[model samples]
Target: MKAVLKRCLLGLATFSLVAAASGAGAADPFPQKPITLIVPWAAGGSTDILARVLSEHLTRSLGQPVIVDNKPGASGNIGSAMVARARPDGYTLLVGSMSTHAMNPALMPNMPFRGVEDFTPLGLLAYVTNTMVVNPSVPAHNVKELIAYARANPGKLAYASAGPGSTNHLSAVLFEKMAGVQMLHVPYKGGAPAVVDTVAGQTQLLFSAGTQTLPHVRANKLRLLAVTEAKRSPLLPNVPTVAETVPGYELSVWYGAFGPVGMPPALVTRLNLEINRIMSLPDVKEKMNAIGVETATSTPQQFAAILHRDADRYGKLIRDLGIKGE
Candidate 1:
């Protein structure tokens, strides 16, 4: 009987040790594993560029590898949906944009997820200098000339877009309505291709972020017409704005970080602080600025507010514009 009692006590001690170890493991700090930073665009675009740079800094800040994976297609919905469906443990995150989180739902029929509901806003990342450029061969020197040419040639001025309902698409469509002109919209699968085709003169006009359009503009393959911001960009103050010719024509595009819904509030706060700090770093700012991206940051709540606001604003704009997803 004593031997039996001794064996039972020994088993109890072993069980206690295992239970304690299990509790310790559960209590281990977050990011016990590598995190995936999904960029819902092709590599070399502004989104991918920002994601890579951010992942590098985040890897150091979080003390774990932050991997950037490019998952481009369906106007950024494919990768965004993947992140939306990912486990909300903060292991997976998305480098999403105004279009993906704001405009896509209203634009795309049968959207897979709710932009605000399916994700937790982590932080606002940066704003790109969106520009209007045309093939050098197009006989337009500036926004006024482009509008005049489009009015004269209506539907003859072929414009390129990332896809239907993309920023570039909406930018051009709005330009047409406000300028009282007509242009052919040629939609491509992504921005890079649209820029390439526009440079090659397959399509003549393109309104895209400077990261994609500026290089070709410098190369003389395309002409810089005007910026799509309401105010002239500080980085390119000398450049005129589309609003200068087409009043109230604004297409300010911004990038942001997001995790799946149900992410811990603590985690969201921690990431927002770290990401804002990283964006404010001088070297990081300079790096992004070189690509015409202005690094901006915001609290998680502020970022969420922007998402909700843009979603509503763009929803109305898309509908009023008679935009339909293909």
Candidate 2:
């Protein structure tokens, strides 16, 4: 009887140790491991650039490595779907843009995930200064001149876009529709390559964010005609808006942080606060602004609201314009 009791006590002690370890792990703070920040685009582009910058700050602030993972394909649906399917443990996050979240669902057929339902919007990161630019060799000074030139050239003027349903493509299409001109559409795999072709004069015009086009503009390789925002950007108040020349044409692109749906509310708030703080840093804002990116900060709710509104707006636009994926 005594021997049997001894064995029982020994087993009890072992079980207690295992239970204690399990409890400790469960009680540990959030982000006990490195976090993944998926960019959903190729490196060296605006979204990738912004993700890397935010990841550096996040790594320092979160006490864990916020690694950036780029999964570029199908107009950003690949990386975004990966994040949507990820566990909502705060370790996996996404730096999603308006194109991926607001526009792609409407633009792409066989979409992998619903942008609004599959994820939790964490915070607004920045607003890209969407611009319409022409290769320096193009005979156009401003929006009016560019419109006139495009009208005169018609199908002779080729405009490079990131892809068939990319924001750049949509912007250029809207420009053609509103201005009553027909420019040949040259779709590239991504914005960087499209901008490259435009700068090389292979394509005479490009509708892309300022981050990619403005540097070339400054170098005289490209000429900035106007922004795509509803109003002028504070960063470049002198630059006219496309609406001024082509009435009712506006496309505002923004980026936001997101995690898989069903993330803990506490974790969502914590991350939202961190992102807001990071974007509000003086140097971060200044650096982004230099390239025509305006850093924006907001609550998770506000981000979600913006996401819903843009999704609806762009969805209608795509349908009305009969945009299709490649």
- Which digits, one per residue and each the tens of the lDDT, describe model 1 over residues 1-326? 99999999999999999999999998888779999999988898767888888999999989999999999888789999999999998899999999888898898889988888999999999999999998889888988888888888978899999778888998888888888988888899877899889888899999998988787878888899899987888778899999988887888899999999999888888889989999999998898899899999999999999899888887888999778776
Please list the residue runs of candidate 2 whose C-alpha ends up more than 4 Å from where it truly belongs after superposition: 1-28, 151-156
What TM-score number comes out for model 1? 0.85
lDDT of 1 at 165: 87
Alpha-carbon local distance difference test for all models: 0.89, 0.90
Clash pairs, model 2 backbone: none
CA lDDT of 45 in candidate 1?
A: 73
The residue-by-residue lDDT of candidate 2 on 1-326, one tens digit each, is 99999999999999999999999998798789999999888898767878988999999998999999989987789999999999999988999988888888998888999989999999999998888899889889998998788778779999999888888998888788778998899998877899999999999988888877888888989998899999999898999999998888888899999999999999999999999999999999988887778999999999999999899987887999898877
lDDT of 1 at 319: 95
Q: Residue 209 in model 1: shift from native, Å?
A: 1.9
